[model samples]
Target: MSKKNKKHEPHEEHNDESWLLPYSDLMTLLLALFIVLYGMSTLDAKKFEELSQAFNAALTGGVSVLDQSTINGKTKNTPTKEQDNQNTSTLTAQNMTQLQKRNELRKQEEEDLEKLKKQLDQYIKQSGLTSQLATKLNQSQLLITISDNALFPSGSALVKPEASALAKALSGMLQKFPDYEILISGHTDNVPIDNDQFASNWDLSFARARNFMEILLQNNKLDPKMFSPIGYGEYHPVADNNTEVGRAKNRRVEISIIRKYQDPDSQVTITP
Candidate 1:
């Protein structure tokens, strides 16, 4: 028996699943959104910013989403209010400690100056040089006054040959305060002076101050930078120029040691 001829059957049509591609992409975006939300909720500020940048790059084609939220067209990484307050408090505490230490050091400097003044006074008394020397301690400086005759001859700026011993003694005392600033100021009587060596009182006084400072700086240990010489030229007189005794007092040299603690805020200085 011959088989009957059969016609080819057509395949049945199924529903289209083309929408799944876009749907999957939407789901991926939703998942990224949830992750960013969770990161923000955790209050992890650093991690949140990192996640924001990552999602913005992945979802927005590398354009930053946080750029729209920027103030003054710049991103600010500002600390929270509580953190700022804590930092301020810590800084205030550090400043207070520094202030306290400065105050303590100032007190110690004053005490050292007082002790040095006493020692000098005792030396002057013992050496029988009290008539030629005097010491006074004030807020700004400790001044040592020496009669002109003690260091120089009449109308001469050169230090006396014997005064070298005195200079050495002073250097020994001053070595204890190596860091203190020293000022040697020279003053002359108002009498008109004209000599082959000096033209006027200004030249005489300046030469006297410089000569005295050179003697003090002869010690190898003393810092020459800490010393300065100034001349007052009979204008700055401690006594009247008209009298013989007053003129003698006016012609003197002053060695002033500056105080270490000079408070910028205070007008009153430590004195003894």
Candidate 2:
């Protein structure tokens, strides 16, 4: 008598999905961290800022790391475009000011040299030395040319007794410009000469230059340290050696007052 056997029912299974939610979140955070590290490795500030904003919006929907005054605990100060342009303008103004000052100095130098040339021309005219002496002013120097007969005898390096007056006059004028460098150069004709006093034209020319330079130094006002003597021998002739008149012109001495400040844009006219 009793009841029938109770029917048996199987238990229902339920899968756990709570762990997958956290796993997906961990993967997204890892991807964001990697992107931030890669951006830090590059030097481009603009690109780094763009990456920071993107990650910030995707992760926190708030201010970026760069906006918080730091990235990876280090602050960066990037100069604005206006600041760079201002620096460039300052440098350009400084350069223009320097150029204007230099041009003014050059103009004053030209006036001073021209005045000295006029004085020399007046003296030459009064002394009747136009045939023996000449003066020229150019960008590089103020040059004075003197014939060989004006300072030395034929083949002799000795300064003539009468030429002492000319040297004295030149030294007196040079005393006005004490800071200038003076070059006293001598030249000779191509004719070869072998004598007891000099073995070649080079020796004779150098001796003549030295003797003349010594006479100039006798004034004591001129600085001996500023003076230099050079001999070109038979080379660097201004005239042909084939003719007597040309050879006479070739055998000469030159005094050059070198310029202290040179203009790079100016054309240099070299005198023989």
Candidate 3:
């Protein structure tokens, strides 16, 4: 074939790869969109933030919108100083109310005790037993002291026949204060006694208290569980043991009505 007449074969047409760039970009955008949709469906702010951070780091290496939104939400939810003050004020008011209620209850208890004391004093005066019997009201208790000679013979635990009336009257008065704890205590002089019925002052004193308490319990209105008996033999004396008069004062029985509500700050002692 002559050179001028030779046919040139057309180069194979290049594949149209120009469309590949846009197609790849479209695929990437679609993947990102699906990921965002899946994260939103979870409804977890923390997970969403982490996913946004990872995606942003991979794409542009910058902070994500999700992270900034979460931070702003936390700041807005934080309690303010004014709100804190309001909460403290509420607690203080509640505490003050409780304290006021306690104070009122204590005052009412004191008034009730005073009324009972006055009634007892009046009874003592009317019975002409002022010399042998004495009453004193203090913060801890209302004490009624009776000389041993009035209730029993010398160095004896048995109550005199005539003293029965006194026990009945006292029991009747005590019935009015049903909730009060009654303590019947016996005391003796320093002189010791050894006899057939009692081995020592301790035995005599305890027997005397028991006998007296039994008389008080004869009244059906008095609760036996509320009463207790104690013996202080030649001890816990209110007077000196050196003189006869002091010995007489030491040999006595005491009935104490203990207070139910006591003030922690106040201690009062009143002489009978």
Candidate 4:
């Protein structure tokens, strides 16, 4: 009886390897789980497509494959839905920051434009030169027009005595704002000009513009670096030169103040 009991005990010892089969399967499943996570972290489009299709075909409803296996005899695997939702939230935050920054820039530009308009109005009123001056405020700059009848003689670039005070006043005000670009532009009516000093309207208009630029520079109201003179001899007409009123309006010298990004439309810049 003792010998028979010993043989049974050895048989029981040989069958103990049954426990190891299930343990081996558990270890394989764990290895597959880690491999799937690593692949997701460094995914490529081709492999992702293959994996997605294989997992979908292996599972019900193409998802929720906790009990499903792949063609390679491995279980389906992926992150939880909650984890994907968190990643989406992070992306949304980054997008919102970019939009907010753009809005801030637009707000700043609008403020600048309004400030320029206010300054232009005050300068015109304080100088008491409204009768001789016409002011235009646009998205890019401020344009102040002084009629040719008020500034110079017909077909001549010579500055009149009455125009001296007007020019000086404008120059003084401009001197206070040195950060602006000042453009002196000359225009002429459609009337022809033939003279010893100026052969055509173009010459007359250009000379008038250049002379005014020099005057502004000499008076310290403009910096030579930020000043330019252009002549549009009968080319840019504010009114029809055929009519008396139009002719008067067309024959003009304009001092344009280019705004420096304070107008809402003038600043298309980014923080970077």
The lDDT leader among the candidates is 2
RMSD of each: 6.4, 6.3, 8.3, 12.2
Write the residue-wise lDDT of candidate 3 on 1-272 in tens digits.
Answer: 56987899989987878998999998997899697767666646556666777888887798766555543245324565678899899999999998899889778778878888888889889999999998888878888999999999998999999999999999988998899888888999999796788888888888899999999999999999999998878877899999999999999999988877777965533224
Q: Number of clashes in model 3? A: 0
lDDT string for model 4 (205-265, tens) is 8899998778777775467899988888998887878899888888888887775555454
Question: Higher-lDDT candidate among 1 and 3?
Answer: 3
Compute the lDDT of residue 232 as modeled in candidate 1: 81
Superposed by TM-score, candidate 4 places the C-alpha of residue 258 at a distance from the truth, in angstroms, of: 1.1
The whole-model C-alpha lDDT of candidate 3 against the native structure comes to 0.84
Worst 10 residues of 4 by lDDT: 263-272
Instruction: Please list the C-alpha lDDT of all candidates, in the order they appear.
Output: 0.83, 0.85, 0.84, 0.71
Better of 2 and 4 by TM-score: 2
- Which scores higher on lDDT, 1 or 4? 1
Q: Tell me how far the alpha carbon of residue 200 in candidate 1 is from the true structure, in angstroms, after superposition.
A: 1.2
Can you list the residue pairs that collide in candidate 4? 112-262, 113-262, 113-263
- Model 2 bad stretches (over 4 Å): 1-79, 265-270
Of 2 and 4, the candidate ranking higher by lDDT: 2
| Per-model TM-score on C-alpha atoms | 0.74, 0.73, 0.68, 0.56
- Expressed as tens digits, the lDDT of each residue in 1-272 for candidate 2 is 86589677988999998999999999989988887777787636666777788878878989865665554454556555677799899999999999899988888878878888898899899999999999999878899999999999899999999999999999988899888888888899999966798999998888888899999999998889999998889887898899999999999999988877776775433344
Q: Pairs clashing in candidate 2?
A: none
